[model samples]
Target: MGESSETSSAPETETFLHENQRSFDVSNDAVTHDNKKSGKPAGDSDDDLTPDDILLQLGGCGLFQILLALIIQSMKTVICWGIGGNSFFAYVPKWRCTDVDDVMNISSTVSPLTTMAINVTDTTNTTAYWNQQCQLPNGTHCSNFEFESSMHTLVSEFDLVCSQSWVTATITSVQMVGMMVGSFVVGHLADMFGRKKPFVLSMAIICLSTIICYFSVHWIMFATARFFFGIGASFFMSIYCILQGEHMLSKWRSTTISFPSWALELNLFSLVVFLLHDWEHVTLIMAFLAAIYLLTWFFIPESFRWLVARNKIKEARLVVNQMAKWNKRPVVNFERMVRSVEKSLSGDEDAKYSVIVLFRKRPLLRLTVPLMLSWLTLGVIGYGVGFGVKEFSGNFYLNLFLFALASIPFKLISIYLQVRIGRKFTSIIAYIVCLVGGLVVTLVQYIDTPYRGGLTTGFALMATAGVGAAWGPMQTMTVELYPTVARNTAFGFLSVLARLGAVIGPQFVYLEVLVPGLLYIMIALLSFISIMCIISLPETNHRMLVDRLVDDLDRERKQEKDHMDSH
Candidate 1:
């Protein structure tokens, strides 16, 4: 049956079901109820409702959903503190070689100097000197250095400058690798066990790892702590979106999924870092804030869709009843209603679905490949522009602030565009915007002007905004494309690719060292490829999510039939 079904369906096209099993079952169950009321032959059972049917009864967008949104939003924002802290904590303040005597006696107090002020012939004279050496080959040099900023950073504390400048960037790449591993592990755990346990455990990991970051006395120790922190943050972020999408109604999905919280965190975190320049203080503060989220253990609940998919009907019913109570709705024949959902879901109990299922079918593989490419572009451009924020011309704080600020409008515009145009077109347009932004930045690198710094920052801000714009639409597309059984795993697969992009992203700065303008040019190329990939995908504007993989293929067949009928 599966082989014949696959051969008949269009390999190039895939679709989400316009109506879900729960909604269809609700209508049939209503007919059964009416037949019973009229003293007619009532066929089958009147209690044939799914979990989503219970959700619809309790009001899809209600107090419970809103509460969960707030919880996810707040926690999502908090995790950014750990993910983004590297920018500030590893910030290399302006420094210069200190004075030394003829007998190798160092001065009690070092001179207040910038890289340009040092008149050393052998040392690199550039203001941004990653390759500058404190000691020349002649040995007539000072190894110790002094920084302009009073606050202690990784650079100042560990003297991670000159020969060690590359270490900071390496740590970020390592963290991205950790995030890749964490997403795969935590996503599988969420699918296998339940969303709540993994979600809460991830939060705890964030809190503890951040504290470890604070107490580290060496750079390697700090990097290790940061790696675990990255895992925790990625775990939390992946599950947060899944939980939000799984709970909210279909209509609100596009608008609800956005980057406002992420943008807001960057904006606020910049101010916090500026106020508290000390890295230790920043790490401690972030750890404390993350710990506060642990208190939300009682408030947050397991995903209803996850529970229903795993066949934990009793637990699903308890959540349903709580949701009903919070939304001020009364349930009738509650046990029967839940039992009907269980029976309907029982057919899939013997079947095991994982990320591998997405590749087992041609239609799903086609859809999955494009989404993976889109996310890879997102990670490359998003973190690529972000990690290089300090390299842009202008004050680091101002650049970070504006870069984050630019994201807010683009994200909002993406939501509006997805609603108006459709997911595929919106994504294509956003990628083109990113491509334009990248080209502008690349152009600035070759131009010579007094306002070059300002120009680079201005155009780079546009690139950041473009990446932000693509996020919301891409998330909506991912959620609407796959079935519940393999949804998080598919997302995890994409996340691993995205993190691979991120691992490559931090190296863009290093690439720039080898060839000027190489960073933005590469970003532009990826953005173009992403645009092409998006063009091949079908629009998923107002489709409902399917619970099983077979249902996804069935929807594709139905769509093909409808297209033929219309012709």
Candidate 2:
């Protein structure tokens, strides 16, 4: 539609325009040359147009955006297995020392606790009674173990218990490390290259790593495979959000965050794991599910926002025209619109901004620091409650299913609240809900009622739902707060820090052994901090997206100059 230019401008003086607050219909003429409403001359002031202005003119939530969102959300569903499936993989069954059971002549069905108490006062089997509580009758540590269930899991396969329990916990930690690394590495790749290639590559990694997990011969091998699986999962999760957010209008962005796909997958995962019972089969099934997404490489397109940010206007035009065609509206003077967007750009055609640039800019730094803390706190509590599902005194499968089910309504509620009150307040409200749930979970431990276990599980479920609700609003903020050039990089960096929280989360279970309710107490503290972070952030509910770094920098300087002049 328009010729390309190689001229570059410094990012220091450029500014962005707010999207025109106008909506068009599918059949409306797309030229929009009139200057009556905006008060800017038609061709002369075209440079004031934002991407949102272009989107509204082209029918924002058209068939193309809908199809793209569906494809990306399907990919999100596939990766959810890797995000929370480790709990099932390393499921610890009821077990006791085989030597102690044999020496004490206790029934194999008798639990270790009952065995110890049954023989406490008996004069006979004195050494065996002590052994039931500690070592074997011969004063030697039990070498062999017996499990109640015949199902195959990491615990049953590798005997990861007692002295080896640390291995299970470390498996989860190592996976978080891999996700942390992937958040940075894959994110950089997407921001550097287009979003399509890295997206397909991540799907391949997930499929291959999950197969490796299925065929693992040793505990270390399985753990190593899970680490790679985590990386791929993080890649898909991060990019999909960016892809979906960039393609659709802000109004529809929060609609699909946790419902239909994410939470449904979790509920399905519980049912699948309960039915399969074997870790190998579970991994194989998940791998097969992930492999299906690799075929999407042919169907999916690169994000138009990413293309524009990288100064590929010619490619951006192709996407824009296609969007218009699919929505049944054709641009009359497409070249003029393209030139407007082109003239609006201030950066060098080849110039690129790295994640490091975010810290150097004062305005971005203010947003970045608080967002990092919020994501980190979410990681700690969101994943901590997930990993501790087994520790609750209930049917593990039912507990998992119910936990996921609770998120469905809460996510819907979050969508309503965020739209009404604004993104910042919605996130703060969700975090406050989680904080209250955490406090209840921690306080319930001291209650001596017979229903204390039920109370604990119920409140933990509430906390998880609250954390789940916060994700939609928080992710919407992440997408809206930064320029497209640095959006993926900033998101990746935040996720890397958040993975640190995920690593810490699984270890909370171990800490709870030393001190009950420690996990929820930490969740309560972190949720309050996240609330404070949300409070400091500006509301992004109706603002247009910034496509260039200069836009933010120039705005920051103008604000400072205005402040000084007011004095």
Q: Against the true structure, what is each candidate's TM-score?
A: 0.85, 0.86
Candidate 1 residue 566 C-alpha distance from true site, Å: 10
Pairs clashing within candidate 1: none
Tell me the tens digit of each residue's lDDT in model 2 across 308-365.
7676877888888788888887663556656645665655445556777667766778
Model 2 TM-score on a 0 to 1 scale: 0.86
Model 2, residue 141: distance off in Å is 2.3
Best by TM-score: 2
Off by over 4 Å in 2: 1-49, 101-134, 258-260, 551-567
Give the per-residue lDDT digits (tens) of candidate 1, residues 469-561.
888888878877777777788877788888888888878877899888777898899999999898877766654466655534545545644
Kindly give the number of clashing pairs for every candidate: 0, 0
